[model samples]
Target chain A: MRKRDLSQFFKDKRVILLIILILASVISISTIGIQEGLDLKGGSLLQLQLEKPVDQDTMNVVTTVLDKRLNIYGVKDVKVRASGDQIVIVEMAGVTPEEIERLIGSPGKFEARIGNESAEPALTGSDITNVDMYEITGTSWTVPFKVSPSGAQHFAEAAEGKGGEKVYMYLDGKLIDENPPTLSPELANGKGATELTVTGGANTVEEAEAQAMAVYTVLKTGTLPVKLTVIGSNTISAELGEQFLNGAIIAGLLAILVISLIIFIRYRRPILVIPIIITSVSEVLIVMGIASIIHWNIDLSAIAGLIAAVGTGVDDQIIITDEVLGKNTDNTKRRKTRTRMSVKNALFIIFASAGTLIAAMLPLAYVGFARGSSGIGTISGFAFTTIIGVLVGIFITRPAFAKFLEIFIK
Target chain B: MLEKFMESYKLLIIIPMIVVILSVGLIAFNGLNEGIELKGGSIATIKLNEPIPSPVLENQLKTALNVDEVDILNNNGNDVTLEIGTEVNPASFASALSGKGQVISYNSIGPVLSDEALGQVYWAMLFAFIFMSITVFIIFREIVPSIAIILAAASDIIIAIGGMSLFNIPLSIASVGAILMLIGYSVDTDILLTTRVLRRREGKVVDRAKEAMKTGLTMSITAIASMVVLYAVTVIFIPQASTLSNIAAVLIFGLLADILTTWFMNLGMIRWYMEWRT
Candidate 1:
């Protein structure tokens, strides 16, 4: 049978592939879509150093709890993981440092006592207005806390019960009880008392004051059941991250330009240029889209992965170009055979190479590889996007190359 | 010169026999340099304010931690990497070392993490094989070339990994990436050779294969050069980047071996099969 219009070669299958791709591109753009990386959309990165002596088991539990808390706090695209023992890295998209500090740093260690009115009186350390480490002329250091007017009234009323029996001072409901008097009349006005003293079993007056200060902050917040301590706090300012991001963008553009120029010089035609350029651009876009969709925080490691992908993708495009131009056997309408062979080879190599990378990355992103959800998502996002780029190359860019080759490649 | 060169059977049989022997030996002894990620261990990075003698710090740490299996890798004399494998209380060790010098960083993964990482590596290799075979079969419509290419790619990776193990180089996440990278490189060269032969060019099939090799070799060499430079930079300049540097080293060796196995051994076997079938 005679070959049916070899010149109009890319008619049936090629057209169908193009329609599918165009539809996909349109759908992706229009929909409630993926979340772009922190690099594209700004976010907060908080690095906390746990107090020494914390093990991986404790860190893991803390990480899980923090993740749950952040989710509860309405921080979307949150990543909570341990970098190692002692440092937990938290990445929260659209969260401020102050919010993170507030959530993670709750100093709610207090001694509270139950009264008739309520189970416990909420008294903050700050409520104990004055803590003094005073020394009498010949005595050792003595520390005392002076209550506010409201606290004084409550103290007086409690002391009146049971003949000047000690009204216990509590922090977070812990009892710090001391007897003030043996008579109700004596306790009522402190008339028989030498001096009213609120003290802890601490070594010196300084220790007492420090302990009081620590308790004061937690009581002031009045938050309960959530015990959090800020061991370490750091913030990467939005402005600096933005400047770094702009520099990265410029670097990426320059890399693409240099690479395209090199490919053009080596291949010496616009035929190869079209596919290489398209695939390269599509790789970046698809990676960004995947990062957005997967909510991967595109950090510096991700940027490195992208640059590496561009290099690999360019090499693949060159192979396709070389296959088309340098090796065509069919004499009668050889261009058709060449185009067919090139696309077939391009598709094969792209699929094979991308298959391996995807296989490797899928596991990295899965439950098995890195226990934490940080590195895997970012690094794997780059791989996943590049693989998508290859698919896009198969459908859009390679066919685009075919059309260009038909026009430009003699 | 041509007649004399053609008599060299060393290129045909001996080299492959050597490769097989070397690959087997390495694979058998691969247990020695089992990756830190695979074997549960402690990897510590200590950054000093200034360069210090390795022995002084090494001895201090070794005596303090009571660790004998410690490697004091002075990275550019500025950073020291100590990998401790024996189980010791990490906090106690860090505290003990902190007295001598500041402990900049340390990471410890339980046996669970290592087991998980190994499992993932296994699945990744399996998925790669299945995916490559299916895709190649669709594109080529010929199972023989596809199978040969896949086998060649696998052989290249195994040999690369074996070589790394034999050389006492730690198999890392980067090396895993390197193995995957070689799969692409190996298949590319095999496909290039196959296409040249299938085109039925004006010259003899063998002659065209040689011509394809010229181009394929150039590409491989360039790639090897780049990877070599990358390896050097990773190893020499970036001490912390163990994974990336190790991967570059594997790729350099794998791509170099691939030029021979993929382009020649596998390509030769495929052509022989095709001729035999016809």
Candidate 2:
């Protein structure tokens, strides 16, 4: 090959575009960041199937109530949405599945009864306006709550003549406080006092704090409208999630290194191997960037899909390289014609294979979406990431690599 | 060089054909072992602060939890995986393990949902196969070559499944994704072989086949190399990535199977078709 203008080659639009895209992808990945799924980040995912099918409004109510309950539990990154007519999906980051089950598993019917256990509830969670923690002593705490106007009147009347009697608290038909607090004689004439306190039953400050917080959460967010059965739940520990993140990064880097070594050994030419490996690596980066921009969650399956995409990507690059550089016995004139034909043939196979791969993964993505929050939902992340990676390879990275090969390869 | 064996292509294809048939037979008779995700069950991984024997934990789980089916898998020396049937309660199950170790992760699925999931997985595989076959037929537009491509893809899946059964890898959603992906990977090399052998007329048939083999082998080797790295990393360093490890395992097996089905079986059919056409 004659001496080509290297600077002009750099000026080619495809190469310039490739460089710009790589830079943009790096920036996007650093700034926006890809979302990690529960598997990659320690969290909990719960799929709740309702007792009966409900309308859109009821579903909305359920979602709102659940969302409020999780928020009250101080789970900031909680997502609760209706999947179908009878299913609700709840996802919380940095929380255990057991914690989620405890918080939302029951209807949380919190009531405070006066006099006897069989007596009617003087104040329910719905009658409470606000719930807050109060320090009763050095290590003891109480959950003080303010009732609504009508509830305050009912409570005062119930406690008017029963100053020494106990005011019992029950949550879901089970008495939460074993030793109920007795009414004081200071306000015995039914003077409606809205503020009341539930004594904490714990030995340490931390335990009292936790008990107060649980009570506050239940009182703040009213009971769920319908019963929910947890059909599926997945929880990962924070330590394990961090380990997976680090391990995945190392594995990805090693995979790229090994793949580069293979290509180098096969081609035995830096000119061919460098572009191939660069294209493959760039494909991964661009996919991750797109994932970051779209806020797609990168779980283990998605990571697997990303690797699968790069694997096929390397395969396509090999095909292109072999097509352009494979030996031919024709004369110089026919050799030039053969190289051009081979590139075309290689592209045909690349596109055909790309089509088949996309076709194969289509059902995985579609079925996951169509099934709502069922079994395939978890696997959908893999399918979506794979499709995205393949599409990026065919549309952006592969064409750019072809352009580079055309400019550089002899 | 390969032309000498062209006459024996029929004989060479018989080996893989029998393996495929036996694989189908095994799957039909014994059936695939479904994972907890596929069938409704519970799986918990406990991280032991100290070392404990597997048998000790197993007996404790059985006695304390009263679970009918409990399998304790000792991963490394510190982590133990408990697989229990759906009869076990998730809350109590966690408490039962807490006495011995800290529960690192837990997954539970109800029977009704898992049944629905199983159905979805079957349909997904079926649809993926049909779609891939259609794409291959469209690309080739020839009956023999398209069938060869589809056959190779099918054989890869069947053999991969058989490998899974032999290796005791349970069929999960991750493995299902890998199998579907195998269809894609299998078709990739088959397309390259068919296109190079049937379309290009630069040299003798064997020479063209040999050239295709060089490129196809490189492609397969690179893919296999990457998967090997992935599998090794997951198995050795990252035990939490069990799902991805399963996927990598399936892909490695399928890719190896693809080499035989593509070069031996698909190549045989393509060579016969080319010779008959002339």
Candidate 3:
């Protein structure tokens, strides 16, 4: 047979279509990019269970309060969503588990009291109108706040005869600042002072700043109505997460290389192995592109799923290649008829295998959804990515690969 | 020569059956290790400025924290993970290790959440198995081949669990995902073998079997190679990704088990059925 024309091969509609699809996927991946999960990006995930199952309104209020608190505390990229009936899943990037637990774990009730501890709180967080942090000196930082008219009047009355007496600051009913500044005689005798500064006890500017920020956040968002129990929390470091991302990419490339080597050893024909590798790679790209489009977080498990999908993709391509190339000594019919029959048989096996694979992964995805962000929920990304990969293999890449073989094998 | 081998198909099938039985026995006697993700506990990953021996760290943590169980896992030279039986104050825990390292990650799961997660894992596995079996049955529309495929899948999982038990790998969410993926992979080779031997008539029975083996073995070998690469990369370079490493490890075991079950047990069953019909 004459040498096949490479230009003509590229000119084929199927080949062009495959190239276009692959290009689209690459573009999507580069532009949209896959979202990294908290495990892949240094972050914290807290699964909070409320004390009692409340109505949707109460849950909404709780989520809103938590979101505001995290934002005020300078935690960017905070996601607070209610999962199931009583669970609230809070995910924040670039925050430590200790920081999150301290910030959100509290009911956040802030109160200031004078000498008469038996009387009601002189000023609560709800009474505060504004809070701001200021640098008093090189190393000193204080958070000042303004109270409402009623709150100011209450403070004046509480501090009238309580000059030089200490004012205690409380958070969540616990005495947080026992040495708060005493009420001065001027403030007690003069008009009710609406503004006061609370100096955070710190030896350094950075420490004071952090303390001031925490106080500001608490006073701003006030307290949550319902109590929360931290059922689960995961924190990953930024450096470690970056290492995992790099390692995953290297592993993926190495996997491709090794798989290609195996295929080459088995087939010993570059014509067949090249297409197999390209098809497998395309399947992966398409899966990732779809992930980007759907905003799926590519966590550790998802990466595993991607590898598994590609592994199975290679298996299916091998089956297709063997079927198309298997020769019979006694050919009783035309070559087309024999090839058609073999290809049909191969497709049947591929479909059957794909069906079973889909069946197996379906539960992982759906059950994870039903249970929310629990243990199994972490692996749901794996299941979903695998399903996408398998579906893409069967529907798009495998058929294109078969067509390539049908054109070139003869 | 092929006929002589066909005569002992029953005996050949018994080998894998015995392995499956032994695997089941192993699992029953030595229950699988459950990770903190499944069992409620605290895991603190600390990155040390200087390397500390795992034993020393474990002993220190146990003494300082007064915890019943403290398991220290080293992550190359970068970090070490400590698993504690009860929740402790994160600040205190960090302070206790301040002299040696810094805590990079801390995860804790309460008992209630863990129990709920464990229930979900069980349900996912059960549903996956049932659905996959149904799909296989529907595809073949034949009793013997379909049953062979399902049995092969089960044997692969059982053998994988046995391997994990022997290796002391815990049954975490990641490993469970690997097992579920194994169900898919095990069926791939079995389906290919069955289709080639039963549905096609291009060659003699033994020749067709041999041809299917060539194809199926290539598939299994390629998968095994990729998994090996993945497993090595994660273990050496990304020690923090225990999830990926565990998943790769379980897949490696399951794929190896699949080769045996598919070639010996599944091929033997089909050969016997074909011979009996003739």
A1-410 per-residue lDDT for model 2 (tens digits): 33564676577786787788788889999999878887778888888889999999889988998898888788858989887788888988877766667677767788878789889887787888877755556556677888889988888877777777787888888787777777777545788998877775777777676666776777777787888888888778878888898888888889888888888888788777777778888988888888888888888888889888888889998888888787443476776576667667888998999999999999999987776545677788888888888888887888777766655666
Quick one: ranking by lDDT, best first?
Answer: 3, 2, 1
DockQ value of candidate 2: 0.81
lDDT of 1 by residue, A105-133 (tens): 54334443323324354244545655454
| CAPRI class assigned to model 2 | high
Candidate 3 error regions (>4 Å): A1-14, A134-142, A149-166, A184-207, A327-333, B75-79, B275-278
TM-score of chain A of 2: 0.88
Taking all chains together, each candidate's TM-score versus the true structure is: 0.64, 0.92, 0.92
The residue ranges of model 2 lying beyond 4 angstroms of the native Cα positions read: A1-5, A134-141, A153-163, A183-191, A199-207, A327-338, A370-375, B87-91, B275-278
On the 0 to 100 scale, the lDDT of residue B93 in model 3 is 82
Candidate 3 residue A302 C-alpha distance from true site, Å: 0.9
TM-score, predicted candidate 3 vs. hidden true structure: 0.92
Q: How does each model score on lDDT?
A: 0.56, 0.83, 0.83
Task: Write candidate 3's Cα lDDT for A1-410 as tens digits.
Answer: 23464665677776777788788879988998878888778888888889999999999999999999998778878989888778899988876657767778788888878775565677788888888755456555567888888888878877777788777888888766545667777777736888887665667877667666777777778788889888888888888889889999999888888887887787788787788878988888888888888888888888889989988999999998898888522454665576766677788899999999999999999977776666678888889989999998888888788777665676
